[model samples]
Target chain A: MNLILAPVRGLGRATLAVVSAVGRGAMLSVDAGRSLRRVDQWGPHLVPQMISIGVASIPLALFIAAFTGIVLAIQASYTFVGTVPLYFVGALVGKTMILELGPALTGLALSGRVGASNASEIATMRVTEQIDALESLAYDPIAYLVVPRVIAGTLMFPVVIALAIAMGIVAGWLTSIALLDLATPQFVRGLRLFFDTYDVQFAMFKSATFGTTVTSVGAFFGYTCTGGARGVGRATTRTVVVSSMIILVLDAFWAATLL
Target chain B: MSIELKDVHKAFGEKRVLRGFTLSVERGETVSVIGGSGQGKSTLLKHVNGLLKPDAGEVWVDGQRIDQLEGEPLYETRRKVGYVFQFAALFDSMTIAENVAMGLRRIPGLSEADIADRVRTALARVDLEGVDEQYPSELSGGMRKRAGLARAIALEPAYLLYDEPTTGLDPVTLSMVDELILRMSDRLGVTSVVITHDMESAYRISDRIVMLHEGRARVAGTPDEIRDSADPVVRAFVEGRADLLEEAS
Candidate 1:
């Protein structure tokens, strides 16, 4: 009876923590929305953040997309050889990159890079009393800090996703020509044959949503951080985990609802 | 402007920090709050600027009820009251000049030239000279404290709140900080509220010293009155005798 009761209590505590976090996150979103109205104040800060989030993230996203596209092309060729035309590999790679892999994988990578950094930086500010200092100075910390990062992330995610898709398609095309013994004309034909403008639009939408989730989650955890150094570390870890999970869940939701 | 806290009650979780605590400070007065660690000294200072609102009671700043205020009204009040944190709390990413200029830029119609001039003047007032481009991390502890003071004073606030300003400083630096506090109060005509455990510094700088214990302002008087207080708790604290408190308890 004691063991059963202890597990139940633990479960209840876990549920409560999760619910509290979600509620807090909703409140933060509303606050951020209101703060966004005064863009003139925070708008200048957004460019630097965008450069940090979008430009700095490009190398890693491209690197991952390159390898992912190459692997997908190779695997598709292996699976479709003799059973179907090899040109199908191009269609497969292109479709997957635009419709799913481009946004999802880039979002996951950035969840670790940008999300973790945002959380740690903001958490450090909180622990060091910089946030309170800002408040004491009559500066709205949400407007000064959180809103800029959120706007940058929302704007840059689609750009990063687009770059990743381009890199992935190019890498996949090169891999097909080098290893799969496929003619460039046939591969290009396959890509053009199945192309739909809606897939690109869908990917753009998903990237923007994922970007918002990754940044806002990090900002929320960091802004509300307590305890000190250990708490900052926890917030960073939670930002990565929660952002990645949310990106994947969002990926599924978009695919199911839109596709 | 003057400050007042009436029957203020504050608690974090089950631990009550301030219990029906009340105090008042006249404009242009320097009051030092001294207490043992975690005795709500900092919490009380925060209440003056509406940084930390009380769970129950009213906080009046210059006859305005500030505890109930929010948004621009609250920020307007905060803009007039400058808070100096224990560790200076400067933005590490920015230079000392940028940090000092931050609050000045918030003033409407202040041009770039005006902000720069105020930053220089504020830095000079704190005896910090020509280290504008250096970051907070590059400055010594004393310099950082001075820079933090400069940042707070650049706005030319009506009230200044100091939270343990002399805690980590050496004896010389501590005296220097105390002197700076006195000079700022006199020159700027800003009301000052200092929270510290340094009894000697408190006695030297404050017009009145408030001693907090057991979640209340147990002793409130001039330095001489506090020194001669008959209350055991006040006696134990002023004399720095933990044994007396233990024995009394």
Candidate 2:
């Protein structure tokens, strides 16, 4: 009986913990939404945050997308060698990059970069009493700290994902032309064969949702973090894992509903 | 009275920190709250500035009950107050000048030039001149605390709350900080409430000293009154004797 109850109790505790976390996240979202009215406070910090969260993330996003594009093209050729036309590689690369890998992978990367940093920065501020000081000074901590990052992340994730999508396709194209004995005309024809504007639209929508999730999750974890330096470390780790998980989950949700 | 905590009660989850604690301070009065590490000395100070609201009872600032206030009302009250943290709590990303200028922006009609002047003047008051360009990380602990002070007093708030203000300072810096606290009270006439375990600094800077034990003010009076108090808990805290508290715990 004890052995059976052990797992049951553990499951109950875990469920409660997740529920608490989600409840806390909801509260933070409401606070963040209300704080949106204080654009005057958060607005001035917007450009700087965009430069930091989005602009600074370019090299890493491009690097991942380029590699992914290269791999997708190679794999498509390997799988479709004898039975199917090789030009299908271009279609595969374009569709996959724009519809799936483009937003999802870039989002995961941003979750690691932007999300982790956001959580750690806010957690450090919380632990060091800086957040309290802001409150004591009558400045809205949510407006000053969380709002700019959330807005920047929401607006810039799509931009970065768009760039990544373009880079990925370009990389795949280059790989196909250089090594796969495929001509530019054949690849472009394959890409245009199945092209639909909705794929890009879907990617844009998914990336924006991913961006909001990643940054808001980061800020929420940071704001609620306790303990001390160890807590900061935990918040950063949690931000990366949770946001990445949420991005993948959202990706599937979008694919199922929209596709 | 300008600041009053009427039977304030606060608890963090399961642990009660302040229970039925009450106190009041008139304008221009400098009060120091002293106690063991976790007796809510800092908690009490935080309530005065609306940094933390009470679980029960009332927090009155000037003429208004602030415990339940939020948004613009709370901010308006906080604008008239300054709080210096134990760790300085300066923004790591900003230079000392920027940190000091943060609160000054809300002051009406203050241009960049005027704000800069105020920053310089505040830094000068804290003897932190020429360090404006430096980040908080670049400064020593003592310097960081003073820079924090500069940030707070730059606005010249009506009330100042200092939480362990002189904790990590050297003797020289400690004395300088004590002097600055006195100057804020005497020269600027800033009503100040300080939380510290340093009894000498408390006796020197505060017109009244309140000692908290368990969850409430165990004793409150002038420094001489506290020094001569016969209550065991107050005696133990006032003398900085932890062994006396060990038996109670």
Best by DockQ: 1
Residues B43-123, candidate 1: write the lDDT tens digits: 888888887899998899977788998878888888898889888999999999999988877777999999999999999
lDDT of 2 by residue, B134-220 (tens): 999999999999999998999899999899999988999999999999999999899999999899999999999998888888889
**Estimated TM-score for each candidate:** 0.98, 0.98
- Could you list the iRMS of every candidate? 0.7, 0.8
lDDT of 1 at A179: 92
- lDDT (10s digit) by residue, model 2, range A52-115: 9999999999999999999999999999999889999999999999999999999998999999
Segments in model 1 whose C-alpha atoms lie over 4 Å from true places:
none
Chain A fold similarity by TM-score, each prediction: 0.98, 0.98
